[model samples]
Target: RVAHMVVEVPRWTNAKMEISLTEPLNPIKQDVKKGALRFVSNVFPHHGYIWNYGALPQTWEDPRHVDPDTGARGDNDPIDVIEIGERVAARGDVIKVKILGTLALIDEGETDWKLLAID
Candidate 1:
C-alpha cells in the first residue's frame, strides 16, 4: 500500500536538478560514485513542462506495488518533481524544494508520479 508506506523525504538537504524545457529529453542525472553529472538520453519530448524539473530524495516508487485504479506497477525510481517559481535553475544544480502535490501518470503499465513543488 503506497498510501500507507512511510518514507523519509529530505526536504532541505536533498539534491535536485532543474531540467531545461527547451533542451531535449535527455535527463542529466548525478553520478554519485564519481561526483559528476551524467547524460542519460534524449528519449522523449515534453512541450507541457513549464517549470524546473527534478526528483525527491530517499523516495522510491516500489516497482512491486500495484495501483488499484490502473493495476500498474511502479517505475522503480525516485518520484519526479517540478519546481514552480520565478527563477530558472541551472542544469545539475543541487538545491532544496518544497513538495506541493503529485500527478500520477500511468506509463507502460507503470505508475510514474510527478511531484509538484516550489523552490
Candidate 2:
C-alpha cells in the first residue's frame, strides 16, 4: 500500500528530531533528553541514520492496542518509516511512498514498528 511519510530526521544526521506528539499539527522537533538536545550516537560501524527517518501521518500505534505478531502494546506514537530511496529527504517533507515491508521492533515492552518504504 502507498503511504505518506513526514520526514523528521533526514539521512546522515545526528539530531534526534521527531514529530511532536503533543503539539498542535504535530510539527517536527528535536528531541531533548536530560534537558539537553539529543543526538543519536554512532554505534560501531554505522554513522548517523543511513536512511530518511520519519513517520506516517494520521497513523498512530495505539498504546492500548497490542500487535498479534509482536505481542506488545504500541509505543504511543505515530508509526515510523525508514525511507530507503536514493534521494535524501529534508525535514518536514511529506513524500509519498510505497510500502515494501515492515520490521517488528519491541522496544522496552512497547511495539515500535518500523515500516520500510521507498519514495
Candidate 3:
C-alpha cells in the first residue's frame, strides 16, 4: 500500500490565486516554482494552449528563453499563473505544492516518477 494517504485539491481559487486545503476559509498558499511546472511535459493541458514541457514562455513572455520567475518587470506568463492554479486544485494533501513535487506516478522502482522526471 502507499505510505502516505492521497487527497485531491479543488478547482476553485480565491483572489490570492492560492488554494487552501483546510477549508475555503483557510486556503493554503504557495508560489508556482519551476519544480511544479516541470510536469508541463506529462502535463494535462488546462485552460488553453498546452505548454510544452519546456515551452512555457520564460518570464511570462521572453519567448526564446525560459524564466519561471519574472526576476524582471513584465516578465511572466499569464498562462503559468493558471497552470499553477490547476496544480493547486488537483493536489490532495497538506495544502502545499511540494506535495505533488514528491509524488509518484507508479510508486515503484528506486525512485518516484516525480523525482525521476522533475528531480
Candidate 4:
C-alpha cells in the first residue's frame, strides 16, 4: 500500500525537528530540551540521521492502545517512517511512499513503530 509521509528531519542533519502536535496547524519545529534546543547525537561511526526520517500523516499511535505484538502501549505520536530513497527530502515535504515493511521499536517502554518505505 501507499501512504503520505511528512519529512520532518532530513538525512545528514541532527536538529531534533518535529511536527508540533499541540501547536496551531501543527507546524514543523525543532524540539527543545531543558529549555534549550535539542539535537540528536551521532552513534559513533554514523553521522546525523542515516535516512530521511519523518512520520505518517493522520496516523497516531494512541497511548491508550496496547499493541498485542509488543505488549506495550503506544508512544502517543504519529507513526515514524524511514525513507530510504536516493534523494534527500526537504523538511515538510509530503511525498507518496510505497510501504515496504514495519519495525516494532520498543522505546522507553513504548511501542514506537518505524515504518520503512521508499519514494
Candidate 5:
C-alpha cells in the first residue's frame, strides 16, 4: 500500500497549488491557481510551518468513502503530509521522512487527513 511504503516528499508533490503540495503558510481566500510557489497571508503569528510538506504516493482518499470520525466523505485526493526536519527542500526535491501521526481537517463537508512525519 502507498500509505505503508516510505517515500520522498517533493517527488510525490508538485507545483500545482491545490492538486498536490503542502498547504501554503499564507493562504489566499480564493487563490486556486496552480504551478509556482506563491505566498498569501499569514494565518499564524510568531510561528510557521516547520516541516517539508508533501503527500503519499498512489494513495487516494476517495470522495465517496465515508469517514467514521467525521461521518463525512473523503476529499478525493492523496493524503497530505508534513515532513518535519532541519533541511529545507525545494519544490520537486525529494527527501526521506518517517511517519508519525496525522491531523484530520474537514473542508466543505469532506475529510482531509494531514500526515505528520519526521525526517
Candidate 6:
C-alpha cells in the first residue's frame, strides 16, 4: 500500500477502504489538497523496507553498560503515504493532521471501501 494518500475508509464489508490522492500542493499547509488529489491514469509508486534482527542470548550486553550489543534496535520502520485527517471545508485554508496507518496501496484512487455496517 502507498504510504501517504487521502483515502476514505468505509465502515465495513469484505474490503477495507478506498483512497484518492490530491494533486497540486495546498501551498498553505504545504500539503496536497483533496482537489489536487486525483484518481486519474497517473499512479503514484510505492516503496518500503523492513530491518529484521536476529535473536541473541544473555551474553548480549546492554548499550547502557560499558558493554555493547544492546540487541541492536529491531523495528520495521517503513516510509509511505499518509492521510492528513484535517478535512478541508474552505478553498485556501490548510490544516494539519497526524498520519494514520501506512497502506500497502493497491489500485488506489477513486476506489470504494464497501460499507458493511448500517450505522
Q: Provide the overall lDDT of each model, using Cα atoms, as 2-decimal numbers.
A: 0.57, 0.91, 0.26, 0.93, 0.58, 0.22
Write the number of the candidate with greater TM-score, choosing between 2 and 5. Answer: 2
Which is better, 2 or 6, measured by TM-score?
2
lDDT of 3 by residue, 11-108 (tens): 33211223333465544344355545211122244432231111111112333443234322322221122123233333334222221232222222
lDDT of 2 by residue, 5-34 (tens): 899988888799988878898778899878
The 10 consecutive residues of candidate 6 with the worst lDDT sum are 49-58
* Candidate 6 regions with alpha-carbon error over 4 angstroms: 1-88, 108-119
Q: Count the backbone clashes (under 3 Å) in each candidate.
A: 1, 0, 11, 0, 0, 17
Candidate 6 residue-pair clash tally? 17
lDDT (C-alpha) at residue 44 in model 1: 43
Task: Give candidate 5's error at residue 98 in angstroms.
Answer: 0.6
The candidates, ranked best first by lDDT, are 4, 2, 5, 1, 3, 6
In model 1, what are the clashing residue pairs, if there are any?
26-41
Best by TM-score: 4
Better of 1 and 2 by TM-score: 2
Q: Candidate 1 on 1-119: residue-level lDDT in tens?
A: 02111122222223433323334663543334366644334334623234666666556788889977668989787777767655566555556666678788998779989876676
Using lDDT as the yardstick, the better of models 1 and 6 is: 1
Stretches of candidate 4 above 4 Å error?
A: 43-46
Per-model root-mean-square deviation over C-alphas: 10.8, 1.7, 14.7, 1.5, 7.6, 17.3
* Tens-digit lDDT string for candidate 5 (2-79): 133223333223333333335555221222436435433334542234445556666778888899988889987778
Off by over 4 Å in 5: 1-40, 43-49
